[model samples]
Target: MKALILKRYGSLQNVMFEDISKPVIAPDEILVEIHAAGLNPIDYMIPKGIFKPILKFNMPATLGSDLAGVVVEVGSKVTRFKAGDKVFASIFDLGKGSLAEYAAVPEFAAALKPDNLSFAEAASVPMVGLTSWQALVVRAQTRAGHKVFIPAGSGGIGTFAIQLAQRLGATVGTTTSTSNMEWVRTLGADEVVDYKKQNFEDVMQGYDTVLGTVRGDALEKALRILKPKSKIVSLIGPPDGAFASRRGMNLLMRIVFSLLSRRIIRLAKQQDTHYSFLFVQPNGEHLAIIGSMLESGQIRPVIDRIFSFENAKLGLEYLETGRAKGKVVIELKDTTI
Candidate 1:
């Protein structure tokens, strides 16, 4: 089958289409005939070797993570799905990718795609969904009456997270361009800061949780917005010692992460807030719950565009420009090259 493969790390120039053997499933995995794939910021970042130290992929490896498709075959131990089942999944850290004719998905990380969502929309949910769930609900413990701040309301994670945070019953605040302020408000954000006109830290304050998505010193400024004892979970991170520990890195790597995050940790401590870095993990059960929300209309996908499978690199280029209002996706078919 023809698939997108990474020949080297550095730039998208390294990624191209090539013929590769179709995947053979393990006892706990299922083979999917991919129809669509989601492009997250991380998808572009990987070519720059951002996760080289963590994920183990061989040379000329396939490139992608989130996919929506039909199950063509199930593993011997798989019971949740069978041939011809519609499913969506995040294949991150699973030693495979979805920008291909087919991909092997672990049964534990695949969920029935919501009947209401097309394959393109379903493909767009995994990374952002898991990120929001792990950050707001699992780590920050956002609840009714809590004030939650999530910056970057126009981005993929931002759009989904705003809705999820509101559903979790937190008052959500977010930052976007002037044009998107009202757009984000429609997504349930209580406070929308037009970043071109207002510095968020100047006016926003007293939050119970902060989901850090923007890079640079924004996370630092966010500290002042939180009440004492609030929680901050950063997806864009100078990863902390805890993250390194969880990844089971060597002592040197843990020390390196500790050094890198020392200032942020110290600042959080002084402000009486807890700071932690989160790398979203794939979970089928959580996707099932998120799927229910999609089915019920409590949440809807915010898709900026859908590119053809052949134009995935162009889609990645467009997404990297930081202009997309929501998620970008790539659509394919069983007959696609």
Candidate 2:
């Protein structure tokens, strides 16, 4: 099996293409022959050690989460899929990632890929799709007539979130560069603020929820646009105590996160709005629903570019530029047995 393995956490130079043993599966898992892998900020962040404290990984680990491929083998307890099934998933197990020829995924995290999508397109959906679903549906409880604001409307998560929010009956608002304003509008954002020309905080107001993919001052500006009792879900964050407790971090780490998020949490409280961090998790059921939506044309993937597996490093570099209009993917040759 060939994989993009990280020998140590540091620069991109730490990553190497190497032959590794095929992944072994547990009773509740499936072995997927990956055909394509999606690249996200976390792909680079992991190797840079940015998430070391929360998502510690062993040396020589693979570095990807979203994948689309065929199931080569299913564990004893697996019931939803079998050999030859086309599936996709965002695997959360940091050790067994999708940037390899084969990956072992929990059965509950793998869903049948939509009939209408190619492997590359399906691979681009899992992480960003689930992030939008989790932030808007699970966390914010967005419903019809609600106003939802999403920053970076042309990026991976924003592209998906805008469409999903509109599908859920929310009036979607988003920020993008002037060049991408008309493009993002096709995704159904009711209000498109050209961030390069106008500030989103000044133009948008009275939102029921704000999905924050950009943090720091961008997140603060988002906070100011919300009405009282609104919710802001941040994906980039100084995570809150609840997140630390959910991940079952040590007391010291928990305290660290508590102190890290204290100021924002207090600010949110003072404004009578709620702020919480979201870490998207994998769920086969949710992916299944999203797949159905794709099948029905309720949501469409926006792919910025596709790189060959050999150029996976370049794909990550492109994503880091913060210029991709949508998702970037790495396509692998299919060699399923």
Candidate 3:
């Protein structure tokens, strides 16, 4: 099967398109014939060695996380799906990814794709969808009447997060460029701050939760807007000891993360708010819930563009520009075996 393999950690030049043996499934896994793969920042960052310390992958690793496809085979212990099942999953285990003709996914991390979506649209959901679900519903415990602020409302995660927060009954506020303000409003953000024309911190305040996806002073600004005892969930930077412990990092790594997040953590405390980093994990059950939401039209996918499988490198380059309004996908021509 043809797959995108990284020979070494570096730039796009390290990504090689070549034939590789199809992965065999474990007892609790399923082999999926990938029809489409969603591109995320982590896909490029991994090959750039940005996450090397935390996520160690062998050379010649595949570089995708979200995928929608058909199940060609199921492991002996698999129960939720079988051959010919249409499914989507976020392969959270690094290195073992879906940017290929086929991928082996843990059964518990795969879910039936929504009937309303195409393979490309479904592929775009898993990573960003689950990130929003876990951060808002699971971590922040968002509820009706709560004020939720999400920065970068036009980006992959932000697009999904805004809708999900609104669905959960929170009043959503988000940041986007002036050109995207009206567009993101369609996603149900109650307040849209044009980052070019206005600062989010000045316009939105007293939030119950803030979902921070950007690096730099965005997290600092997010902290200032929260009401006392509010929570700020950051997807980028300054991962704290709690996150390190959750990932079961070594003592050395834990110490490193603790020291790294000390200042931000202290600042959050001083403002009478809590700050924690979120690393989205794979969970089939959560995907199932998201699938239902999609099926019922409670949430919709926003796709920026779809690239052919052969031009995946160009797709990654497009994603790196940080100009995309939503998820970028790579569509495969042959999914049937």
Candidate 4:
């Protein structure tokens, strides 16, 4: 099988196409004939040695987090799906091998693709879609009539967050550049703040939840927008317990988190708010729920571009620019064929 392998962690130049042995299925896994894979920032970041503390990987590893394809073979212990089943999955584990022509994914992390979407579209959903779902529904417990503010609303996760929040009857607000304001509105954001022209902190208020996608100082800004007792969920690691817990740092991190949380608790006393660091886990059940939403036309993927399999490195470069409006897909074979 052909795969894009990283010989060493660095830039796009490190990614090379090579023939590699196809993955053999584990008892709880299924071998999928990958049709398309989604490119995420993590794909590029991981090889640069950013996530080294959390994920230990061997060199020549394939890098891709999401996949959409047909199941070719099922492990003996896999009862959830069988051969010929079309599936979509968040393959964040198992060596991130979705960039290959085939991949073996745990049965629990793979869901049947929605009837309404194409393979490429299905590929785009697992990571960002699940991130939005987990942060809003699972962590924040966002409810109808609640107010949610999502930063980077025109980006991958933001696009899904805006649509899902709106579908659940939440009043959604988001920040993006002026060029993306109308696009964010189309995704169901009730109020779109042009980040380039105005300060969202000045005019936005009373948000029940603020979903953070950008890191560093932007994350701190998100914490301030939430109403008293409201929650803030961020994907970016750093600050607080989530990053420490994820890194498997020592108990010192626990003590640090305890002290930092006390300060946040004090702030909440003044404004009545809460905060959490959300790291989305792989859940096939959650993917199924998203599939239903797609089939019902309640939500749709926002795709910025589709590159040929040979051009996956190019897709990585595109994502690195931080300018893509939505998901970027890499098709293994031309569907028109």
Query: In what order do the candidates fall by lDDT, top score first?
Result: 1, 2, 3, 4
Error of 4 at 53 (Å): 1.4
Per-model TM-score on C-alpha atoms:
0.98, 0.98, 0.98, 0.93
lDDT for each residue of candidate 3 in 1-337, tens digit (9 for 90 to 100): 9999989987888998989999988999999999999999988888888888878788788889999999999999999998999999999664597889999999989999998899999999999999999999999999999999999999999999999999999999999998889998999999999999888888788899988798998898887789999998989878899989998999999999999999889999999999899999999999999999999999999999999999998999899999888999999954232
Model 2 residue 325 CA deviation (Å) reads 0.9
lDDT of 1 by residue, 1-337 (tens): 9899999999999999999999989999999999999999988889989888767788989999999999999999999999999999998987799999999999999999999889999999999998999898899988999999999999999999999999989899999998898899999999999999989999999999999999999999999899999998999888999999998999999999999899999999999999999998999999999999999999999999999999999999999999999999999964221
- Worst lDDT run of 10 residues, candidate 1, spans 328-337
- Single out the weakest 10-residue window by summed lDDT for candidate 4: 260-269
Model 1 regions more than 4 Å off: 334-337
Pull out the clashing pairs in model 4.
228-271, 228-272, 228-273, 229-272, 229-273
Better of 3 and 4 by lDDT: 3
Comparing 1 with 4 on TM-score, the higher-scoring candidate is 1
Alpha-carbon shift of residue 188 in model 3 (angstroms): 0.3
- Total backbone clashes of model 1? 0
CA lDDT scores, all candidates in order: 0.93, 0.91, 0.91, 0.85
